[model samples]
Target: MSELYDLTIVGGGPAGLYAAFYAGMRDMKVKLIEGKEVLGGFLHHYAEKTIWDVGGIPPLRCEQLIERLSAQARTFDPTILLGRRVDTLERLERGAYRLRTDDGQSHDTRTILVAVGRGITEMTKLDIRGADRYELTNLHYTVQNPESYRGKRVLISGGGNSAVDWANELVGIAREVIVVHRRPEFGAMERSVARMLEMADVRTPYVLRELHGSGDAIRAVTIGHADDEEEGTGIERIDVDAVVVSHGYTRSYGDLLAWGLEIGQHGVRVSDQTATNLPGIFAAGDCATYANKVKLIAGAFTDAVLAVNSAMRHIDAEAPGMAYVSSHNEKFREMNKRLKRPL
Candidate 1:
């Protein structure tokens, strides 16, 4: 028989991580499961980008924010299972629930917090044949390090926010930056698109037709007008040090969406208190939606706290409505003693 946890959090993103930390304040046995081997959720897609919206924190790299959130999540020493995707959910007697992962392992919990933001997202890969061979070399789906493209000619393919953002970021770094998009209009912010067009070489209504390479490295690429139906007609080949493909992403909720929950176009429908239709189940972050729900990092943290508190009350109706503020909570007494402070 699997040991039952007080709360099981699916997804290790900002909301899930913060929930784990907040659940510790309620003294609940907790477990967190993340589909990817690493935490941070979709943040890993733009790890090099700077995040300025998180409350009370100065501007910092996204990867650093992930590090801090992951650390705070471990304050209670909850069980963390990585690289496991929850595939099924079964409700048992007495409001107990069993969650099975892709690996066939089961976790029994009295309450659940579904925070799997946007489910398991996969980047849209380049459609060109044999393009994957260059992934390990100069072909990139994401810019993990902007410095790596220093003094090099780089070509970015796509019209989304990421594509335009990367082009702007590489302006001073890359010796030459070229952006090729199939549509004349870009999907990124108007200001950002304008900035990118002003700094880099922007080609509209064009698409990458072929990749020329030797061994595993891409040497150059062939691009042509998107409207031209002929394969080789009206094409131009340009030399490049690196090629970045940021088509977009495909989101999959897997069996989770199949579960009997009030799901809407945005995500699972929850109440102001973060309660789902089913008892002992709640949701947070982008995966959960409510009236006037704010879809931001700070909003995710707010949802996490509400979901944690609701989970605690579901377990014990007599429990407090919410945890005391961290400054006033007894749970932080010993933790505060370890911190250095001025006399």
Candidate 2:
């Protein structure tokens, strides 16, 4: 709502949140705009899921890690605008930048950190007939709870990491688990694919072509080869209780590319300092590309620290020191006590 800020980060994920916090360390007023309803971003979907790769933390659940990261990010209380999509960015005649959002909200900032990971693309849809009717009702794109499918026949579609992971997790809870994929071979990671293939209670290689049944709940599904040209005869119908679709995702770059920002196939290109080709603008996280950039959560934190430092320097011209403590200090007591050590 305000007209200006020292920094405005266009995401609320690890990169954006960390940027806000690091910027705050330099005493800069910051705002983080997250397009989603929640602050954790993709991690919110697998809140109970454990993360093993983070350096110091020993496999904490996605939710726990997010909560701890969020606590540290919010230490300086940056303005967090959830469910707001950044629609456009315009350069002002006087040298500031205006960030416009879908909800008609705008902010003028001296520097912008674009950490909007993957650019707001939604989960892929199943695209089967009759699926639209049940999308918000019975058919779901996300697995909200495994208990909801207890003792019920469920079909999960996709051969990707998310689909395979969900199928592996639901084997014990659902009465039956059927995983359908378009391709003959699953494109998921080796470990997940192996686990899904080994699940005795789950079925695989079934591709959904249509939906059957009516009313409040699903009854069955029609299947066929993803490459099948025939419509009806090659189709096989199977009885089921619920359908979970996890096809994958696409980036939503929209007009940002045409608006003059340098973009690659995955995202915008940036320097090591997170500076994009455009002056006073920077990008980080999944929406950024640079030498030595890594897409992991841990990597994003480093990107945030560097991006914030660069943004502050852009504003002050001669800002002192790194925005965040480059080295952890022994005397800097218990601020991130909630952070769990790696196992």
Candidate 3:
């Protein structure tokens, strides 16, 4: 009995944002629900990272692109509901869908789009005490702006791709870059790991043990050998202005498995049209999977289009396969009025 919407897009990531924009372009009444306090999904986890794969987008920071997506998504002003998690989705007797959230609110929609990527994930924090206090000043799980560390000594913890990648990028900006990892062998790009080894102080098989700081700022850290092979080998103190923990994230299915959708090891099973086997339901972005699927932001853009267009068709069989992009003058006219011209 809730307000009925033409489409209820779940997950406010890139795919959901883009899908909302397109549905609005089609002049459909749409609502965008996001579980996180903010819009952009895991991208927030790497806000400072540069993305180069998105087509025609000049290399820009993750937050920069997220801002662009946020702007583009507002072209038609879809109702954006942030910090609301869709816990379960059920089909109404009349074929419309009803989605219930953890907050005890429900929404009625003509169609649905599942764009939640990898469900909800939280960054793994550094296991050092007093590290939490420095989070506001010197500690960061995701680097929102790389320039913030300019000319300051920085230490990155973790041996994965994110850790090494951040080290590689910060080498030029920070006064000093040091990478501390529990494993000597790194699981990062060979080129990046090689470059970091050459330019940054790469520590091997070391785990963080202590925080040497005062008030809200961290000025140094104590590192220890990670393995019993070198138990009590030694501990070292390194001076640093900031610590970036790229320990990655822990992912779970959450409510997706209980939704009764066909999910696989890769992601939700989706058809060529971005439609799920369930009628009136579709999916896109990293949450949906199919043959020859490209797992990139660029691909997510296409998925949004496909899912929206397919949903449009589901709503009205007479609708075109897709409203032509860059050709529909009528659509572009209104969009252009609100669109920020490239600088």
Q: Which candidate is the best by lDDT?
A: 1
lDDT for 174 in candidate 3 is 98
Q: Each model's C-alpha lDDT?
A: 0.93, 0.79, 0.86
Candidate 3 weakest lDDT stretch, 10 residues: 225-234
- Tens digits of per-residue lDDT for model 3, 94-147: 789999987999999999999998777789888776578888888888777789
Clashes of each: 0, 6, 0
In terms of TM-score, the best-performing candidate is 1
Model 1 is weakest, by summed lDDT over 10 consecutive residues, at: 334-343
* Candidate 1 regions with alpha-carbon error over 4 angstroms: 340-343
Model 1 lDDT tens row, 84-129? 9997999888889999999999999999999999888889999999
Alpha-carbon deviation at 17 in model 3, angstroms: 1.1
Score residue 312 of candidate 3 by CA lDDT: 90
lDDT of 1 at 116: 90
**Model 2 TM-score on a 0 to 1 scale:** 0.84
Q: After superposition, how far is residue 305 of candidate 2 from its true place, in Å?
A: 0.6
**Predicted structure 3: lDDT:** 0.86
